[model samples]
Target: MQHRPIKTAVFPVAGQGTRFLPATKAVPKEMLPVVDKPLLQYAVDEALAAGIERLVFITARGKGAIDDHFDMASELVAGLKARGKTAELASLEGTCLEPGRITSIRQQEPAGLGHAVWCARHIVGADAFAVLLPDELLWNPARPALAAMHDAYRQMGGNIISVLEVTEAHTHRYGIVTPGRSDGLLTEVRGMVEKPQVGTAPSRLAAIGRYILQPEVMDVLAKGRRGAGGEIQLTDAMAELIGVQPFHALTFEGTRFDCGDKVGHLMANVALALERSDTGPALRDWLRSLEL
Candidate 1:
């Protein structure tokens, strides 16, 4: 059965990035830069690559900077054109989305992931849409994980979530998926447990940031039931749709960096820099020269 095309992608950027502390005090955590582009840009570009027609940012009061970052700076463009700076102008191309193609909704409160997603329900109205958490940066320029998940959604015609294996000890840190059957990278998600107590995890496979969810999920999220951490957990809402709808997880082939963590954020910068042609050689040499 063919499902509705996923044209809208929702980004939850309302969180207070307490983990980064002072740096995030004045800036949205999603604005944090890795290498060069902000974390949110990578997620936005990935969503656009997956054929998403519109972008919806679920934001909070202090997150206006996220909106400003995407707005076209006419003066900057004019300066570049006048100075004949084509390279610099080209860099901004990826940051620009056509007018009306992107919009934002105020989450109003720090409810939780489920609540954040529900904030965009009106825009996503009665359609299948993709959800991307910018903090989970997946490095795979050749084939973005979201694009791959979109491809699967076309054939499978149901909810598709991106997942990867975490260490057994780290299972408590993620939503553990219970597998019914598997073929290669795809697995039937029989059920899932959110932040399962250490040793009680059902499986080592943990759901990551990318998701292609149907409209019914918005209804589930609307209930605002709290779980795990006394917050509206999206995982619980997703679990409710399992047997009622087709649900599966794709074990994406790419390196993931939890940019929410300082160490992970630093690691992402180094990893991406070392892989770039313009920076790799020098960066690699410099890394080798380090005494650590």
Candidate 2:
């Protein structure tokens, strides 16, 4: 079946980063820096790398910083250019989107992931779209995780979700997928249970933050039925499409860090910092000297 091209992606960033406390009180969690770039920028770059043309950000109140982050910093760029800061100016490349290529919609309230995604339904309009959570930072620059999912979507053409094998004990923390047929990284999704009760999970394969969903799922979320945690869980909506639509999970190839958690956020920064040429040597040396 020929599928509509996946040209757009939805980023659900409306959540208040209560986890980060004082730091997030003034800034959106998505705007928190990983190493040098903010968390949201990494997700945007991944989407762009996957040939996504339009970016739909589901934002909430006080999230205007995200919109400003993507806007061209005219004064900053001019200052760098005047000072002959070619390197700084070059680093800003690809940060700004083509006018009209990006759009932001307000979530208004702290709804669940499903509602946040549904907010972009009008903007997405009949096209298969991707939803990327800024919290799950996949560290695979050479072949972005989303790009890999896009490749699978082109071949399978239904609903593609990125999965990772988490420990059985940790199944309750994620939306676990029951495997049907396996073909290396691609597995037929038999079913999904959002944060299933302990010892009740079917499999250890859990859905991460990346998803390429068909537009029909929007109608399902439109019902506004609450699921786990009293939020309109996207997993519940996607589960409904499993038998009706072709749903498959791709075992993503990369190290994923859940930056929503404090420890995970720190790990991402240290890992990325260690990979940087400018900081790697010094950071590695400092690490080697650690008492722990």
Candidate 3:
């Protein structure tokens, strides 16, 4: 079957980031620096790489900083250009968001992930769309995780969520997929259980942050049924679509970091730091010095 094109993507960034606390008091956690870039920039680049034209950010109050991040820095760009700082100009240029290509909706309440996604339904309209969780930093050399999934989406439609093998012990932390047949690196999803009990999991394939879902998912999320932790969960709504739609899981070639968690945040920074040309050698030396 010829898969439908994905023109838009929904980014849910409404969380209060209470986990990071004081530091996140004024600064949005998405703006927290990871090496040279912020968390949200990584997600935005992933969406753009997947040929997404419209970017919808589901935000809450005090998220003005995120909106400002992509806005044109006219005076700053001009100053850099006047000083013949070409590299600086280039850095600012990459931050530009095409006029009107970006839009925001207030999630208002600190509800579940499903509610946040539902807020952006109108922006996504009636078509297949990608949804990327900014906290999940997917690193890839060939194609970003979303782009790889889009490639799979060319053959399979309905809903495509990225899956990575997580330890059975960690299954309770993620939405685990019950695998059916394998399609290249993609797996046909027989069903999904959000945070299933240990030893009772259908499979070790845990749902990551990337997803290419049909607009029909909007209908499911609209019902806003509270799940898991009292908030309406996205996983619960996605579970409702399994057998009904042609759902599948794409095994993306990338290392994913749950940047929302403390340990995961530290891991992403250290891993990316070691990948830098100038810092790689020194960082490696430091790691060797630690000796475990």
Candidate 4:
């Protein structure tokens, strides 16, 4: 059977970045820069690279800056053009979404991941769409992570989620998956346990932020049942779709940073900076000089 092509992607950016505190008071956490570009930009670029033609952003009241970020900065572009800053001008390329390719809908309240995703139901309609959480930044420029999952979706023809092995001690921090039939990086997902209790956890393979879900998930979320943390959890909705549809997890080949945490954010910057030819030498020198 041919799989429904994933032409649209939903970005759930409505969360209040309470973890970042005062810095996120005025800015959305997704707007926080990794090196120079904001976290949201990386997620958008990844979606576009994976052949996603339309972007559906689930945002809240304070996320207007995100809307502005994707809009063309005419004055700034003119300034760079006059100065003949060719490189800078080139850097801004591919930042703007063409015409009607992007849509943003408000969540209205701080519900949860499932609720945030449900906000884009009308826009997503009845198509298979990918969901990317900007907080999870997967670094693999050679082949974008989402593209890999899309490839698996074509072969497997079901819901595909990105998974990574975490230590047993950290199992409770993520949505743990029960492994079934395994084939290299791809594993058949028997079930998913959201933030399982430490001792009772199923497996070490934890689900990450990437997902290619069928439209039936919206129907599950419509039930409005609250799960862990007393909020509507996306994992809960996904679990409902497991038996009804083919569900599998892909161990994405890449370095994933949980940018939602302070340490992870810092690590992403240092790691990406070290990979840049221009900044690597200076950054390496500075790091070596530090007395840790």
Which tens-of-lDDT digit does each residue in 142-241 have in candidate 3? 7899988888788777899998998989999999999999967989998888888788899999988999998888899888789888888888888898
Candidate 2 residue spans exceeding 4 A from truth: none
Candidate 3 global TM-score: 0.96
- Across 127-191, the per-residue lDDT of candidate 4 in tens digits comes to 89999999999999998889999999999998999999999999999889988999999999999
**Model 2 C-alpha lDDT per residue in residues 161-210, reported as the tens digit of each score:** 99999998999999999899999999999899999999999999999999
| Model 1 steric clash pairs | none
Better of 2 and 3 by lDDT: 2
- The lowest-lDDT stretch of 10 consecutive residues in candidate 1 is 1-10
Model 4: what TM-score?
Answer: 0.98
The model with the greater TM-score, 2 or 3, is 2
What is the lDDT for 150 in model 1?
87
Worst window of 10 by summed lDDT in candidate 2: 89-98
Q: Candidate 1's C-alpha lDDT?
A: 0.92
> Which runs in model 1 stand beyond 4 Å of their true positions?
none
**lDDT for each candidate structure:** 0.92, 0.94, 0.88, 0.92
